[model samples]
Target: MTDSLAIDAAETVDGRDQERGSDFARLSRRIVQAGLLERRHGYYALRLGLVAVCFVGGWAAFFAVGDSWYQLLVAIFLSLVFAQVALVAHDLAHRQVFRSRRSSEIAGLVAGNLSIGMSYGWWMDKHTRHHANPNHEDHDPDVAPDVLIWSVEQAAVSRGLSRFLGPRQAFLFFPLLTLEGFNLHVASFRALSRPSLRNRGLETALLVVHVAAYLAALFAVLSPGKAVVFLLLHQAIFGVYLGCTFAPNHKGMPMLRGAERLDFLRRQVLTSRNVSGGRVVDTVLGGLNYQIEHHLFPSMPMPNLRRAQPIVRAYCEELGIDYLESGLFSSYAQALRHLHEVGAPLRARGSVADPASSK
Candidate 1:
């Protein structure tokens, strides 16, 4: 293994100007063409089973415990499962989770829309734009304007509020910013619902299906208030899971773009960093700690992330790429203070046009 990695490393050094992206493309084609994409059927079964146990199990726990305290616990568990659902749905979007296109499409509708309140077209389109221009100041759709940054007037108003309510807000606010519908999807959903929409009918139908399913489940099980509580608890879990996580990657730092042509791809790889305290945190975070890998190899399955880590690092390191990284808690802690950090004039003054700028 070491010998092979050494050769790959040497190849990376000489292949700097050799257009090895195409080489890797051809190489991958050969490998996958040799009966790799034709997957056995068992992976789909396991995926279905896990999805069922996670989503259904959360609702079951809510009724099974019947305690107010347990509601929060079930919500937390469900939130984790939902995070997994996001990751899995992402896998489905890229055609990694399910081998069959039909299976992938159907599963994506269920997991993406019904499970997560995201229409497949809406989420996939944004994700596609994200990959096309990650961290690009001009193009990457995911590089949306942040609400964290405050103008001078706003900062003045927030000074007292931040001190008095910052910690409390941190406790509850992290979940609010990153969940599917609340913060992340607000802009996205609005765009999807526009009159000039591309797939408005299909996407709206999916959105309706998800809302109707949630409402039906709520009405069938308990009173309306309890159903609302269930929904709130559910959103809260995902909020924290996504809020802390999604924030860490791009908040504290500036979005950088590379040269022309490879502009966004370079920004993504150079600007993204991997957090590594250990395997425990990495697994829980769905290997999102490996953010650079996730960005560069978006189609790669989440589980194959750790496997590709060393290769990705070696290649980028040889190319003088800037890979931002910190420990598990430190990255998130930095994220917690991101709005403040970026709010500072010193940090905010310089535009993030270059991918090399780091605080």
Candidate 2:
């Protein structure tokens, strides 16, 4: 790795004109030709079947708990099941599971809207833009003008709640993520209600089903206090589970200025970080542990990411580009450190400046 670093530095200084982007394209072609793009139908079937069991079993357990304090425990379990279902929806939106785009869309709607009360169309629009331009403050919805600032420019413009939270964001990051489940559901409903959005009726109907069924189940099985507690536990854990999985993928990595024109390969690899873990972590993150590979090949099947890791890593090493991989705990630490660093300007200046002026 040290030797490769030296080579990378030399290439940067010498202004190499070797068309490195083409090399990336060639490697991508090789990966496809090697059948890494092929769907593993049996694997997906098994995984989705297990997810179905969890969802059904979780709800069954909740109903069975019936006024018992143990319903809290059941609620936590249900949150995990919902998180797994969301992961499946993510894969479906990426078109990684089915050959037919229509099949993937249908699955995404069922898992996201009907099951999780999130709009598939809303998520798809945001996520597709994110993939196309990760970490860009302007183009990437994931990083765009959020309360948690990722760049000094964003911090400089912080106001209201964001202003109050700017200096304390690192400490608040995980706590804030606990609310993301509610935030996402609200965002989905808002998106579906937009007059310009197509198929709003379908998305709205699915979300209505999810909300009605979810509330009905809780009211049927538990007292008012227990129901409130159950909702809190379920949504909080669901949010944290999602945040823990996704925050590490790009939070501590490079932030792209919207103006820069980067090749597909450089853009993806540079902005993404891979999490290092075994089977349990992989299962929880749904192969998002291999974020670098997933970003490079967004449509690739999840089961194939582990197989492609070595190939991608070696190629990156040969190209002398950095390929970051860290344990789960370390990744979170890195993200927090970054959040702290970006917020420094806000702390030091003690005033919000115009973001345009920062530019």
Candidate 3:
């Protein structure tokens, strides 16, 4: 394995690299020939229609149920519905549903800011950086040390909540994710202060309207106590659902160290792990189960990703690059194991676990 990696590194040197500039070009040609790059307008239309029906139906049910505990069930249903809306917003952000940026952003604002109360502009900037460098410790915001440490170096310097959670993070990961929805809301509101965010006025207005309308609906129908419970439960379920959907994509994959570079194909392929499943998994994850394919072709329509998978896998195999895929549960286990390993040292010392000690 070490020798193969050494050979891979050597092949990447001096611009003579077989897979540097030309490899992705070739793969892209194959993908285009397969017609996988074409937009799936019909698919998006059907999907958006179903999503709208669910969204409207969920709210209608919420009103019909009134101030009862049964509303919690409605909350669960709506959380799932909201997640689907966010997925549509994700496709819009990637331009998978629209050819023009203006069209995509207009749809994105409605799906994100108005429908979901997430700031599309803020998420786009962050998501773009993540796609540019999927698992780079320095560059990918998704992998950066925060409430949970992703690397030994990060574990060593861990402070505050991260330090407290490091040793037990794997166990607590899902529980912590219950707060992810709330965190996203806070981050969206906070990002309005950043001067780099475009359409600041429009973004703020949409978000404010969403919050005001959502709160008013809850309080007007349910008692204050039930409304608060409904709000917290809905957001918590949404957070957990979103986190679970994304965590399996790159969490346990190889992390690119400082200044380590690869051609675009290897950069994305080596750092992503796909979850193998059928249509149900595809729907649940919004096509993110095909993480490798999606990373390789960010603009590819979600429905087209499955068709592109075999072509991509065969090409990677031909080039002697690893293409990782695992069963859905196996992927989660790998991610949790990685979390456990990263905190091994702190667990031993009764301080923060040292990510290196597990090695």
> Compared with the true structure, what per-residue lDDT tens digits does model 1 show for residues 1-359?
00110112223334532543553443334333343334335655676588778788877876676635546667678778877787667667766665455667688777876677776656676666665556564555554333332122333334443433332333434544545445544544666656654457766677667768767866566567776777776776676676565656664555544454553235566667678867777656766787876665555555666666776566557667666778867776765565454345423333453455663
Q: State the displacement of the C-alpha of residue 26, model 1, in Å, after optimal TM-score superposition.
A: 10
Model 2, position 40, has a per-residue lDDT of 88
Ranking of all candidate structures by their lDDT, best first: 3, 2, 1
lDDT of 2 at 189: 90
Better of 1 and 3 by TM-score: 3
- Candidate that scores best on lDDT: 3
What does the lDDT read for residue 99 in candidate 2?
Answer: 65
Candidate 3 lDDT, tens digit per residue, 70-177?
999999999999999999999888888987778988999999999989999999888988887889999889987889999887888889988889989999999999
TM-score of 3: 0.92
lDDT of 3 at 34: 82
lDDT of 2 by residue, 297-349 (tens): 77778889999899999998998888999999999999999999988987876
State TM-scores per candidate: 0.71, 0.91, 0.92
lDDT of candidate 1 at residue 235, scale 0 to 100: 73
